[model samples]
Target: MIPLSGDIGNAKGIIRENLGTVETRRGTTTLKRGFAHMLKNGVVMDVTTVEQAQIAEDAGAVAVMVLDKLPADVRKAGGVARTASIRIIEEIMDSTTIPVMAKCRIGHVYEAQVLDATGVDMIDESEVLTPADEFHHIWKWDFTTPFVNGARNLGEALRRIEEGAAMIRTKGEPGTGNVAEAVIHIKNVNTELRRIKSVYDAGDEQDLISLARELKVSYGLVEETASLGRLPVVNFAAGGISTPADAAYLMTLGCDGIFVGSGIFKSDDAKERAQAVVLATTFWEDPLKVKEAQKMVDERQSMLGLDTKNLELRMQERGSTA
Candidate 1:
């Protein structure tokens, strides 16, 4: 993998050198990205309780995201959505053998610190919760825990990677059960990447610099991404994926995997829906398998989806400027 930042030391070395203490959990860019690599071609599910976490594990999730509310519920109970309770997070952690992920509000560094101390396998600096800092995101290089952030376009995705995000996911309009926004974001990133690759092939060094400037990221990182023809880190599809078809569509679109939030548990058959999503994600290229997975759930049992246009809060818009 291309190191967006310089080679970082081990997690313990990072903590001792940067934070003035020795912490067992060391956060290194390589280590973090390595963790994300293990999750490729898999699904990461959102869960609020130990039971849900266990259910996700049983359903073959590579990881579980511990959150206080499902994205749809967070939208309905329109208030501050912060990191989940530590007690619940700890319980989920204890109950599952699979990696446990939890969210922190965007730019909330201290909240990240708290989650890091709690020892989550990964931390999502999520827009699903209200962003705590609008102008800047957390400098993820400071933490031991790996972070995943949302992006709506190529520039946002590259900027987050430059800032030390171990993983990137399209910031689709969450809780809406709509996949259109996710499709747009992923296509935008792919299109921009192809454009940059062509420019690189032409050996237009100055134009590369201009492209980096437009993307709001380091020129070296831009060049590296162009050379590789993709983001250096794993990229996952997220937001509004409520069905097996949605999961398979994204996989065919070249996403490393999918993140299903309110889609699974909010359905009438959480267990069946969860398992079907995993099956679809794993066998995404096989139309017959995907069709079978789709048949496993009834559309009527799916969560009441909100049209993306009608959403009062556009979480996907967060960090879009960056």
Candidate 2:
């Protein structure tokens, strides 16, 4: 079991002191990216209230993302979606020992600024919220706080990176309980990475340059990615990840971590589901362990999945330029 609330608060205070040093070192890509690197292979769960945040931390989540509402509720109640309330975010941060993250609408600079000023550990320039700008995203390099952005392919990932995203997640169809779109996205990014790797291996600089033009990203960034044979920074899987199996499957696909939105709090068995997903994510390579985690939750208790082919709002398409 985790520590009591009083102990947790004391530990979080120590963590904040260390984080203050990290924040001072902001604008340094190494420090910004390193902050994300520390959370690799962990689960980051979406939460709306202090109670949900505590549940997530106790379930062994590496972090909790504060939101005004769960993704499902946001999609069901279609209006202008924006950032979560500052009071709620601060309250969660105070309550949880784990890192606290919050989302801002895609291309919303001021929202990101407000979140940063509020001292969140990370900011997600998310497509889940309504787009505040159609043709642009926040220039993340200017901020001291790290930002994570969503992408569907290599080009989009590279573009977000160029614009200063410290981390990248697949822009899977959020709010739905189906993992099909997330699967499709990771596969797409892998295919594109393989294509670039092969081109670089063939020593075709000219071809790489042409591909960079096609991707609309800097040639140097493309070359670096090709040499590395993967994204330069950590990449996670997000959206529609509901079950333990879903979490494990994405881990097998080379994601650095997992993000659970409506998958936890929206389910009938939130606490059990949260713990099970974390277990599966951590032991994804061990089939027996994954099976044990899968047994912790019942399928009937899961959220009703939405079909991606029949969605009215495709959140992933909102602020994508490539």
Candidate 3:
């Protein structure tokens, strides 16, 4: 097992190298975005307790997101899911040396405020929780901490970025161990990205403006995304990812990182699965390495996956629009 102290120190060095001293200043867009950049090629695992957070860290997760219940449990319980308790969040924060993150219900400004005030390294304005407001999401610019939001397509992503989200993740049907919905979402984003890139390359300003209007986002944001040939912020694949192969496949699909929700702790082999995912994400470009990582865990131990089409609650659609 990797020594906890050594791994954390190494993580700090990587953060420093990715985010220079000046860029570390709080609240600025660059700083907020820079924070997400530091987590590229990494895994962010959802954890409900200090022990799970420790396992996440020891398994080499770049960060741990505290939640009241795993996505699977939330799905099964069928109630108003909310942000994790402050007491639990604080306890996990105290226990783990790595950066800690927590989720707030979509559009719940107070929940976000509470999380920001708790001094979490980042806040996920997540659709996995019940939406507090039907039509809108929290304005992330108001907070000093970086925010990550879920997106189903380029339009939703750009709108979230316009609202000051520092990072974006595909809102795969959370709680479902099945990765199909996540795959579809990423492909949708990629297809749009390519179309816009082609439009920008052709210098069709009118068509680009039309696309912006069609997407219900600002033209400038569309143009910016087109120019970059990607989302303006780091994009991670979240929800439904359950195995080493799942993590590696998303990396191949252009995600900057991976977010495993119920995929870890709900599995029959949480520790082995967590380590395998981290390894697969880091070496996704290498088939041999991914194969080795896959061999570390048993497929039967994975969480029983749900079919996205049959889900009672479509978590991805909650607060998807601006």
Candidate 4:
């Protein structure tokens, strides 16, 4: 229901007025968040090469995430998964008109710095990579580029938001083509929000303070979240989405958009699956349109799904302590 274009433009206007220059810390933060807002109600696909990036762009992706290995491969390779090669990222940026994003290891500030220097449109402090620091995440507020972090619940989401994340995605079990985890996460966040709103509506200020303590976030942020009834920033669905129905299912659950990693390229028909996912995301409320999108991909060609319960590694659990 949010008018994506108009809202983003207005956010940009506010950013311009607040900082007077786009190069300042506040200005860059505002610009980054505003830019993310522009990608609402769209799909961001993961691509490893220039050709794949082109395929995703042609398939109508609003943005592309550049990665050396897809989530499935990352799970298979089992090593220190670092950022994508600079050359690959640069090539993708050169090839696509849409925004290009890259992932940095959780808590790896230098990797983030290097990606920022490469001029990526956005940086994901991703758990998909083997974490660089077991205890801390990158201090996102220290960087000029906007960052997106994953959350399994409202506490994690708020912690990342407090750390200056411009956007948040549900930390659904990545690398598994199972949507069940994603569904659980979104539901958890929504449920927690409703509870917070009820407390706020009942004028239980002390309970709100208790909630702030439980979530380990600022009282002001807790208050704002309760008042708004959702995260202040754009929230997208990510991780296990592998089909048109999966994409639309999350959209209907109130996510702003989706991130499909290892879903398209890992499938038998990458191009067709990419386009189908985009169409589903755009017209998620229309069941007929969703069906048409589903018809675009052969069920036999979808990525072989892995049961979340059987997976050896759970990327979503990486930042639980933070």
Candidate 5:
């Protein structure tokens, strides 16, 4: 319950006696930390199907994404808000104990709220794929959930962080093959932060965004946000992540984690690609291990489109697709 620290043991006992054991835990870990452990290490697998999700879980993804469509959905559907069916999401969750997340339409808090009640660990207010009625801003503070939102630039990332999103990510255009955009954003955000810091020393308890725009960097936090402890939440580099090298690059660029969709499954080798991405992110400094792991990933992974098309057909059959 209270993370077991100090003489709070005696205090905990008193509180439990007065309130209830359930009340104490509900206040501490469950309510306060909700799914923090689920993403502590931050390796998320973006999958379009149950089979891909199982592979991701087996290959070491801390979490997985299951949706009816990926990038293609974003391009074709005009907006990707609420693209995945509850049935699809539940199927993935049922198959994996690791946490599961799905993308939601922008400004579609209702869809996100539904997933939260369904026991989803996270949601991406994915502007890249969401078909929101307006800008993809969801009032995260109102939800009993932790969410991750995508940003093309640092300004958006900062806004999401301020909005209480537990995670931040780079926008992957759902179906695009290019990995250049994400790489640039990660590099710039980190590089720009250094510039902002040169002008002024951020006070211990000052605003992080002023420092961020001043320092010109984007972190999960702005500096004064959460004590800068191991990153306020998790920051996973997504979009256009193509190979083991790209994964390694992001980790070096200072990503807390990554998510791969078309990059892994779309490759000529799915299992090998998935395994390689995992190995690359987890053991980035070890070249020898990376080399060995390289062999584990399939150089020719399958693309995500194949998987998405199948989901579309199935949804058409049901006539009740999201």
Candidate 6:
């Protein structure tokens, strides 16, 4: 395959790009010829309105996440056993040229199946906030759709990958004006995984599978982490990334991207907050950028006495199902 690396400098309307890859001036990227570049880099906006989508695109986000309601509601409603209106998803997609993604109830295969036909670039099988469903462990073998599932930590992430998820996100639920719990879990997994190779004693693919079964994570998960040498197969640090510093912190940890749900809206100036997030993600390691961006988001959010603990109470009363 001839590399198209040097072509981006100038092109005649992108006559051809990166060998089989196609890029139109309109900003639509097709990754047929080379790597699937949809999920890499930049920010994915979390929005409930079309206006938000426009703001995200202008802010230079690579994608936008659309939801029917805030994450808190999404969790409580997870058992409805149906899909949200495709129009909401379609409208969000139409409103922006950037990639559009939506959240479905956990293990909601029916909803996931419908998303395949929605012209969406990705689907987030989020557990942080999903409508209830009788089924669990959404089987990825059913379709070739590129999926992103929510993970509280490393083990869940590994399983999802084994099941064929194309992406992993912080299980920390978004919305509620607070960061999700999955944030801490991701780091721990990354740490525990340090011993993966040493424990396996053999790098053969089969060895990894045997380890996963022993760890009770997931066989597919073991395969991906062992293969790519990364805990998340294109994992993104999500939830609780309310400020630029938080975004940068995750990126510094080697996250593929950051998903900002309620963080953007929590600020007094939504547009400015969104822009700061995008910039921080691109320049995460730069202390100068993080310091400056934090001032903006920090001042905007009132941290005193903000209680987001109801999610736990509700969960204790209501447990998980298939």
Best-matching candidate per lDDT: 1
What TM-score does each of the candidates earn? 0.94, 0.92, 0.92, 0.92, 0.75, 0.76
Query: Considering summed lDDT, which 10 consecutive residues are worst modelled in model 4?
Result: 4-13
lDDT of each: 0.90, 0.89, 0.88, 0.88, 0.61, 0.63
For residues 61-154, write the lDDT of model 5, one tens digit per residue. Answer: 8888877765544555653235588888898889998888887766777887787778787777765443555534676655656678776555
Query: How many clashes show up per model?
Result: 3, 0, 0, 0, 28, 13
Judged by lDDT against the true structure, how good is candidate 1? 0.90
**Weakest 10 consecutive residues, lDDT, candidate 6?**
26-35
TM-score of 3: 0.92
Highest TM-score scorer? 1
lDDT of 3 by residue, 1-322 (tens): 1111101111111232226545443466666778898999999999999999999999999999999999999999997999999999999999999899999998999998899889999999998888999988887767778889999998898888877788899999999998898999999999999999999999999999999898898887788788878777889999899999999999999999999999999999999999999999999999999999999999889888877887678988888766
Give the C-alpha miss distance for residue 97 in model 3, angstroms: 1.2
The runs of at least 3 residues in candidate 4 whose Cα sits more than 4 Å from the true structure, single-residue gaps closed, are: 1-28
Rate residue 313 of model 4 by lDDT.
Answer: 87
Error of 1 at 92 (Å): 0.4
Residue-level error in angstroms, candidate 3, position 211: 0.3
The deviation in Å at residue 102 for candidate 1 is 0.4
Q: Which segments of model 2 are wrong by more than 4 Å?
A: 1-24
Off by over 4 Å in 5: 1-21, 25-42, 72-81, 202-231, 297-322
Clashing pairs in 2: none
Distance from true location, Cα of 268 in model 2, Å? 0.4
Q: Which parts of model 6 have CA positions greater than 4 angstroms off?
A: 1-37, 72-84, 201-210, 217-224, 302-310, 313-322
